[model samples]
Target: MFEQLGLIGCGLMGGSFALAMKKAGLVKRVVGYSKSPSTTDRARQLGVIDVEAPSALLAVAGADIVLVAVPVAATEATLKAIRHLVTPNMLIMDVGSTKADVVQAARRALRDQVGSFVPAHPITGREVSGVEHADAELYTGRQVILTPMDRTLPEQFAKAETVWNALGCRVSNMSPESHDAAFAAVSHLPHLLAFAMMNSITGQAEGDDFLSLAGPGFRDFTRIAASDPKVWRDILLSNREELLAQSRLFQQTLQNIEQAMQKGDTQALEDMITLASETRAHWRMGAQRTSKGR
Candidate 1:
């Protein structure tokens, strides 16, 4: 068990993590800090943290494990804030959606102490965000991607894996570049499409009327459009390169379908639809197998 967990951000992700650690008996104490004083105070009152820290450095003062749960844009500044107190044995991790930029931030901010930092991306969250919405079961049975740098300490890496595993997470390792690229296609690009789909509909004069007629399909497809704007904004920008590449590929496929429609080619349209339906069915089968621990 860790002696103390120094939590930065104190919002949904950080607060949930602290609660999970406490539930699993993985950490003895949690000291939390946030950009907003009220947030830190609320986290303490909610029992998400045992102590309130005034600054990031103070939060890390005596903690053996630290979680930097800030936005992708604030990662660099947050790491620099606590770098002075970072120790070789301390295991630091982040929950940012994108990994490449986060790894770069750690390298620049921590320098020789970078070995203590292990970049992590936990694939789970709710549409609502804040300390009040934090759930102890947030990471349970979810996938967590860890991207450790070459300089990362083996002992610290092992501890990081143990902590997440204790919380009931399925932990996997990947390079920062590969992690970012893969997520850009699976996660980031979908958020981008959701945002655009919402805008495209709402921009019309009959938008409200059209929304009234939306069925379960539309609701299911557009659920992610209601995600926190600022958080998604930072994520989309941080992994823009890979996201854009995926977007171009999506456009190519869309154009092919559109051309088939223009030519009134029923056979081509049916073929494309069949291909997509079969692909989605195959993916669902594989996903079910993985969920059963195959």
Candidate 2:
């Protein structure tokens, strides 16, 4: 519930957020800006925003809330662009994939006003991007994590939760460091593995043939590989340290499976597969239960 919503980066994530907030009747007006003039124009035409500001600074002017949905690498620049316009009463939040880098960016750019900045990661998106693909239901039944800093104000934090919750998101809180570490293992590593797997297949001589014969399993696993490369590039690099550790762990697991097969250890291979299958099934059922409860 705010008089104005300042939206930076009028792309898929930002556009979807604006639409969701509008659907929830949470904001009176929305002012949007994007680096690409055409994108801002498109957002205005699509009714994702009420007005397209000429610049980032102008977008946040007089707004009670600001949502930064730029790439993780550009967080600092976005923050710097709007820092002068921020006030203590305004609630600032980011929809970044990584938290540590964004937290650092907020501290560097927001300075004394950093207490109003909240770093958030919504665990939901499609392989496709852009405002054209934005949907008001995008965040429905999704998990949104808030990694608030020690300096973050209680009022701002509560407002951030209220906004996301109004949009039908399940909100959870954690430290920025813990957020990065956990997501690196579950989210980042999976995307990287999918990308690597697709590349490995395509680099082979029978790549096209293999793809032509690919079934549901291959299709499902590599679906995320079809996501916007530029977005994934920023995410991968932003959490490279934790991703590297996860990568090493995956490599070791792969080697263990390979060794088992080479040694004709059927039981070992079966055990590994069984563990994965059972764990996935259990997790899936738990998630279904949670969704039903909601």
Candidate 3:
């Protein structure tokens, strides 16, 4: 709906946004930027954007909307680089997995311009990444969480919502602190645990053999562990506090299971298993609602 749109990283999320905008016919102009020439070239080949810029500022300068899609740790650096170039009319947003750090970083860099910013996290992403894997329908029927605090004006917030809704996404607003705390428990902690579990057995002497012997259960549990390590590492560092708490809870649960097994309490172990199964079933069905809506 805006005349100018800026995408600050032509990777998975940024590239996908380009594809979505092109397919939906919502934007007449899109300017893209990337530190990696190969990625910028690939996004161009995909017809994801009209022009590519040499620097972050060139991409963002005067654009009505700017989406900073980069590693969580690199967000502040990107914001700092482009903060001066961003006008008050430009709507700033990010597709970060961690929110608190990103919001704080933007506030530190933009100050008054922060009122025009919208901190957002789309709950949809693929295990694989890159412009080649980008799909316009990735956001369709998906839930995009916006963490716009009190300082953000209602008009600016509405502009952010309008853009996402035009892309077929349902918008839900949350506080930055709440977003980080929740994702730490549900998204970040689970990914870390999966990586740990896979590494626990895979790091053994016969790592390859252990991997070869893994059944479907092991395969499913460790799938997320295969996601981009750099991105995961950045998210981990950004949300370390909440993740640590989640890890402690997992450790305590493991201890409880150990105690039950040692005491030969079959009922207790089965009860725990059943409870986990039921909860997973409910959540899985809930996720299906979004997928099926697509």
Model 1 lDDT on a 0 to 1 scale:
0.91
Q: Between the candidate structures 1 and 3, which one is better when assessed by lDDT?
A: 1
Cα displacement (angstroms), candidate 2, residue 120, comes to 0.8
Model 1: runs farther than 4 Å from truth? 285-294
Shift in Å, residue 206, candidate 3? 1.8
How does model 3 score by TM-score?
A: 0.94
TM-score of 1: 0.95
Q: How close is every model to the real structure, measured as TM-score?
A: 0.95, 0.96, 0.94
For model 2, the run of ten residues with the poorest summed lDDT? 285-294
User: What is candidate 2's lDDT per residue for 243-262, written digit by digit as tens?
Assistant: 99999999999999999999
Put down candidate 3 lDDT per residue, 203-261, tens digits, no spaces.
Answer: 78998887888899887777788887888999999999988998899899989989999
Q: Count the backbone clashes (under 3 Å) in each candidate.
A: 0, 0, 0
Estimate the lDDT of model 2: 0.90
Give the runs in model 2 whose Cα sits over 4 Å from its true position.
285-294
Among residues 3 or more apart in sequence or in different chains, the pairs in candidate 1 whose N, CA or C atoms overlap within 3 Å are none
Q: lDDT for every model?
A: 0.91, 0.90, 0.84
